[model samples]
Target: MNKFLLVLLFSTAMLQAQTVVEPDSTGVVKSNDSLVVQKTIMRDTLKPFKRYKAEGVSAVVGEYVILDSDIDKAYVEMQSQGMSIEDITRCQLMGKLMEDKLYAHQAKQDSIMVPDAEINGMIDQQLQYMISELGSEEKVAAYYRKDNIADLRKDLFEANKSIKLASLMQQKVIEKVEVTPEEVRTFFFSIPEDERPVFSAEIEIAQIVVDPKITKQAIDEVKARLNAIRADIIDNGTSFSTKAVLYSKDPGSNSKGGLYTGVKRDSPWAKEFKDQAFSLLEGEISEPFETEFGWHLLYVEKIRGQEVDVRHILLFPEVSQKSIDEAQKKIEDLKKQIEAGEITFAEAARKNSDDKETRNNGGQLVNPISFDTRFDLTKMDPTLSQQVYNLKEGEVSEVFTDRDRTGKSSLKILTVTKKYDEHQADYSKDYERIKKLALREKQIKVINKWQNEKIKDTYISINQDYQDCDFAGDWLKK
Candidate 1:
């Protein structure tokens, strides 16, 4: 995934707000001003009439503007996504919107603009990711009610630009803040052992996967079938999407009429899928081509710059029952041999295990979080998590099936490589983690100091209503 996309997807919680309200009543408000006030509450509701007298209608108007627009929208969206809106308040929304607007304005004022090259690079990254997620541009466009992928690309690019700019600004701030080793160590020592993160025991695993080969005859047969389908599509004037929904074997995309979304050029499916899709002109249908998944019949619906909306029907060659039985039998035989002391598990895994990721590393599983060959019981996959909890060190597990990161299922045998019981964090073991925490604290202090001193020097004015609203930062005071 592109770093910007990752931030956009996960970093919404980090946006901070700085709001300023009006101090006194009745002044002419300017349309060009960045901040505006609207009344949300009745004037009679406020206590201490003198304070209300000072602030007047601007305070009420400011509150109303924030509530009606930003707060209400956020609440509705959150509720639509199954979140409770009861806890959300207008104040929170106002704070967030104000912060967002402030940062956006600052970026523009500072000339923090992404160049065309950067935009193109980001667009490519986003497109590939969307392709992988939605399986193809055709599916994406269909989902978004777009006529083609080009339209989808334009929308995605615009949506992602705001995300990218915000990230760029945040990165500039974070990069300048450094954490020293000594500070890291000291911070680690300060945290209570009970609160320290427990290191998970993980494993390093590899696999040497051998997909059941599809013969040339099978490929030709599938291709011939696809060609016939394409001919029918042309002659009958049937939509490619209708055909894909009926015939495509890619279950993930087939249900969505063979459209995919958020695809970028550098994604996993980008190279092979994109090359084939982009090669064809609009409304052109192609003969079957082989990809890792299977053989595919593709139809190009539209193209936008480097992005293409293409529908595809996939057909994976059937693996013979005999072949599957043979593979299983071989695994069973290997297990027997290991049990009978013919060879060590590590040696057997190195020689015979099909898993490339874990085989070379003696078939030990690694923790995804720590990226280490140690297992923390809590961090293990739920099924594996339960099974591993009961096993002792050096125990071999029953042959079981599991899916890889890409959701491809495979049969495997897990061995207990290492185990660490729950334990308190210590300076000796957790110094680096602690140091990072301390450094971040120090960085925040630096940022706060800068904000306090610099905000006064900058041009800032809050509407009269918000003048009394307490803000954590000194920008309000200015």
Candidate 2:
């Protein structure tokens, strides 16, 4: 916790690219602090930071330098992490700061202005993620020296500005690059034979998803029923909890009287419901609203920072057999059109599919785990996987009754457009995989080229302390 130890930890972490941003911590070290500098480096290496023990600057890059205190403080923190200063770490820290200042310089020249509101929202998102990762807001507060997360908003302003500008510069550098299938094959074959990755059994699935339609009359009836329940709670002093326990159909929350706790702002729940829930003042009851489940009335119970707890009464619309048959019939017709060569499956999906997520992507069911347009048979639903297992590639299954992810009963037709067996990747069978790999390689190459070009144009300087140390890039050389 002391300055000397903190510097050692940071000094070691610099080897791993860890503590470059918290420059203020360096101010705690003695101007001539040689203890950590001596400790971090072996007796052979020149003590670049130790000379600053009594001086104004440790190392300079263009107009920027790691101050004596900052560099030495980093040395102590590096020691704490069981690391020591070396040419690589010293270069990395200096490189990181130089890159940051470069972005800062260019962003100022461009007169870029990322609004405070946007920056604050990003800060909140970061804090929320940290809170989730660290186990509590209190822990995050302790880490950041804030009594509450809100205090962090203004404090991270400069960091956010640098982040935004760097992002903008990166986008400008790598916009509009595209890769083709041949490029994909080349990229796959270029991999070293010994390092080639093997792949698992996977499938590419497609479907025509139909929503069991809820007629307008059924929707109105559900809404009317929810409104009456809300009236009883608001005007008659009835408890929201009692009505939720008795009427809510959501199995997950009904046992708890439909109360959801520790709900973060960016939850994966339906956007409309989450937005309305967060919009309400505490003790306010929302009017009847519909989500994927059905109609609902929500009452905000508590709000804490970016998290919320809410109680709701949920009701499903009465879906008639006629509506179900109509959905099935329409899908049957769509299937016939595809079979008759009147429309492609992808065209039909784009124009008429009910599932929005896959509709835009031509109905291919992408594996969320690997981000592949495939799924492993072992991981798939037993019943559905068995039904799909016997089918050959390019074969479409008969229309079958199934429930969508939202648990709505509907009819769908499945297609296994592509299939891959368990093996090391081959260019012939894994073009999708190759395309992604090649595209990323191209993007990375483009970014590196952009960075080198920018570094060449920028005014740069390094203090004599680090002038002779071998750094990774020509970052310091004009």
Candidate 3:
């Protein structure tokens, strides 16, 4: 028989064996033997299970039915993420899907609520990512085998929501899992001497930035321009969205008519922006206000209890070329003073650096990914790596022009404060990294135990064909 016909025959076989058995007061099913207990739990869990009328149902995990096609789709997703799937097998995919379904099902049972707005935001981000990767909305829909972008979004929303639930459930299981210092040492020493990981060549860098001054006249001009646009919208009934599209300097929202949704008090927005947004009633626009990025006029589109949706137009004051030249000269002169031993580099940075994030910390740059002072040379940003490639410890680089994320230009000079050559990891020197590894291992064990226990309590039935595959968990048991 063909695979499809075989699946149909199995589905019919399963339908012919429906039986319901209730558990006792101790939450254990009464049965003749161990095998019978397992069978009874399966039947009890599937009391109201809907019978599949067609083929291709690979397994049933609690309330979810995994289909044969899901494995293929998963493989496609892994490929899109640049993962090598040559060593992976269909059985592995089936196990992973079962785990996700189990987590998602248990999350709902535990009343782990994922907000609709959060899921919708994730869907929007995913849609944008897919569109960017595939060239357009039309291409994304076609790639996903959907008739239109709406259909694609519907699918993505459901998929992303389930994935988020699974992730949250897993996090809850391991949130408190930790390892002490003793455990960290034990974990590191447990590895054989020859098997210890090698430390990569790394450097710790610091910098000083000087921002060009924006004159008061320039600031007033920007505020006046924003006020004029706001007045036109309120007085002449011109579209605020049209004005945002034409004038807003914030690239993130300008193209979308400055629309932002799900703005809560705790959301990571500028204090000024949120203050202005929350102060307005629906359809009310605010006076021009200043934020670190620029001046903005906020229009409250809607208020949904704790969350508000707002639209805005941003305008930043212009910096004159003379001001830019002056900033560059200031940084250059500071470099000379530091080189001549008149003022220490760190002292100069602490006193004069315009980069607020590092100025208070004496301009010391921390690697964001590692949250440490050292950065691995191979993994560092190409531009920065080249700048510091030849510099020795305590040597400062020539002043260079840099642009912030907002495209604001600044002059910067970097100093390599420390350097490390590749070497075997030392216990004391690598303690923090080793501690992280130990903690992660502890979390993994906790999650594995949780999964094993949940698998036993939850209802899961694998297809006879896939039952022979060796799985990490006792999934064959109820």
Instruction: Pick the TM-score winner.
Output: 3
TM-score of each: 0.64, 0.52, 0.67
> Candidate 2's residue-wise lDDT over 1-478, tens digit each?
3343353344442222311221111111112121122223222234344432543454544344445444443443344334555542454444454555565566666776666655554444444445544555567565555687556544455555554564555555556878977787776666666556566677788877887778899989999999899999889999898899899887656666777654555544677788888899989999998876678899999897776778888888888989988888899999898888898888878888888889898888876555667788879878679768877786778888886433567678878888878877677766776676667667656755666776788777667666665554466563
Model 1 alpha-carbon drift over 4 Å, by segment:
1-159, 176-181, 192-221, 235-238, 261-268, 304-307, 333-376, 403-408, 443-478
Whose lDDT is higher: candidate 1's or candidate 2's? 2
Between candidates 2 and 3, the TM-score winner: 3
* Model 2: lDDT of residue 399: 86
Top-down lDDT ranking: 3, 2, 1
| Ordering by TM-score | 3, 1, 2
Q: Tens digit of lDDT per residue, candidate 3, span 388-420?
A: 999999999999888765677788999999999
Model 2 ranges with Cα > 4 A deviation: 1-145, 153-164, 176-204, 216-221, 236-283, 291-293, 298-315, 318-353, 356-390, 398-409, 419-439, 442-478
Give the winner by lDDT.
3
In angstroms, the error of model 1 at 143 is 14
